[model samples]
Target: MIDLLKEWIINIASLVLFITAVEMLLPDNSLKKYSKFVLGLILMTVLINPIIKIFNRNFNISVYSQNISRSIYDEDTAKSIEKYKEESLKNTINNFENNLTQIIGEKLKEEFNLSNNKLEVKAEYVTQESKFEIKYIKVGINSGKVQKVEKVKVNIGEKNIEEKDKLHDDIKSYLSKELKVQEKIITIYKL
Candidate 1:
């Protein structure tokens, strides 16, 4: 609390000193003699500086009381966090697939400029008897509602079957005309 007060006082004092030094350099006349120095000092120190100090005090109290650093995570906490992240990502992909049917229904409205939501994207991974299959759907606005779908098959033993890379080429090809996404933007990898 004391430190905060000191900082605010320093800031206001610096500003007043700078303004007073500038005012002193002006031409010396009868009206500019004693009155200018006194008025400038009084206005800066009494009015502007106090108001600034009040604002700074309120801001400092609010920020300190908020206790933002209490949310920091440790190493074991970080590992559990990563586990949750992977699970959530898997659920997200499944939800995307389940929502695809309804999403496709709205594709026509989007493509014809009848709706503000212009694109619908869906992705899924299918574990087959001997291999893995990735499927992606891109529904967008073209002449009317246009839907494009792409599928990629990968063997279980393939090291390149990371999630992001698995569908990189297919997604790029599918949405090439609709979205100007760069190659680096799409990433896929297995957990």
Candidate 2:
């Protein structure tokens, strides 16, 4: 409660300071003749700014809580999976990460016309039951706009390795079409 109060006080104080600075910048005669203009500026700063901030805060809080809940559920499920307990699983996951990075880098360069230096890629593997699920997160810079791509689940089952490869290829094809980049330029991470 105290922390929330402190934050509110700080935000209100900042808004007041911002409004006062703008008021001070105007010519003295102008402010005197057009006091209504000063009142309008103050109203916008004090009312609209806080309303916008409230909506932003609400959105962020909901998003953060949802992510936290999902992560907790995933961790619990992973703990019960037999494959995740095996020592070899770690090495397999590491190799998968390396492979995904290379693939994603190549794809980004070809499909999105992205430079290798401007692409950021991250991949991780999450296990459920006997299957491995890959998650890929990528950011590509093209013409100053940062395009973000995420694939939440890619199945890599031991008996379906060929199918998994096909899925990966399909993802590359889809991203190339959607992002208007060459299929070679899109990067896929194992995560």
Candidate 3:
């Protein structure tokens, strides 16, 4: 077992030295990144190969090495990887938007007693900020039925309840502050 560990360490050190030498020889250009990425993957495979062998005595590193080399230079494989990355990013963004809407809806319902709520959150990657930024938020409320005054109002000294217009402002203000968005970018409407 100690011999095996020593052999793995020697192999990894030699690979690292080889990779560094090759990286030094590589010209600084767009293709350098691809070369480095492939080299890094190869190094990872080398690092994991010993562990794999420990578990499966019949495991073949040569086959995996050949496959990795074959796929590394394949243009179709590169394009497919790029496409997969794009699709993954889109799915993540969609999930974030859905989750944000649900959370905001629940918060409004709990805080403002606003039900039948709809929310639209538009977000985009901001390169300057190095993060995703919310472009705008649109909230729609569907519970806008005015109940009939069941009795005549005879009390002249009682404070009136907060109005719906104030409620709209409050919701907008709350969302703007909570989301770190401008009030102008947040639109609240009755449906």
Quality of model 1 by C-alpha lDDT: 0.52
lDDT of 3 by residue, 1-191 (tens): 99989999999999999999999999999989999999999899989989999899989988877999997869998899999988977887788788888889998988888888878998766658767777778888777587565555566777533225887899989988887889887778765
Give residue 34's error in model 1 in angstroms: 45
Q: What is the alpha-carbon lDDT of model 3 when measured against the actual structure?
A: 0.84
Put down candidate 1 lDDT per residue, 29-72, tens digits, no spaces: 77666767676765555445445656775544335436654455
User: By TM-score, how accurate is candidate 3?
Assistant: 0.54
In model 1, residue pairs whose N, Cα or C atoms come closer than 3 Å (at least 3 residues apart or on different chains), thus clashing, are 111-141, 162-189, 163-188, 163-189, 163-190, 164-187, 164-188, 164-189, 165-188
lDDT (C-alpha, whole model) for all candidates: 0.52, 0.58, 0.84
Model 1, runs deviating above 4 Å: 1-8, 11-71, 103-191
lDDT of 2 at 135: 46
Task: Give the higher-lDDT candidate: 2 or 3.
Answer: 3
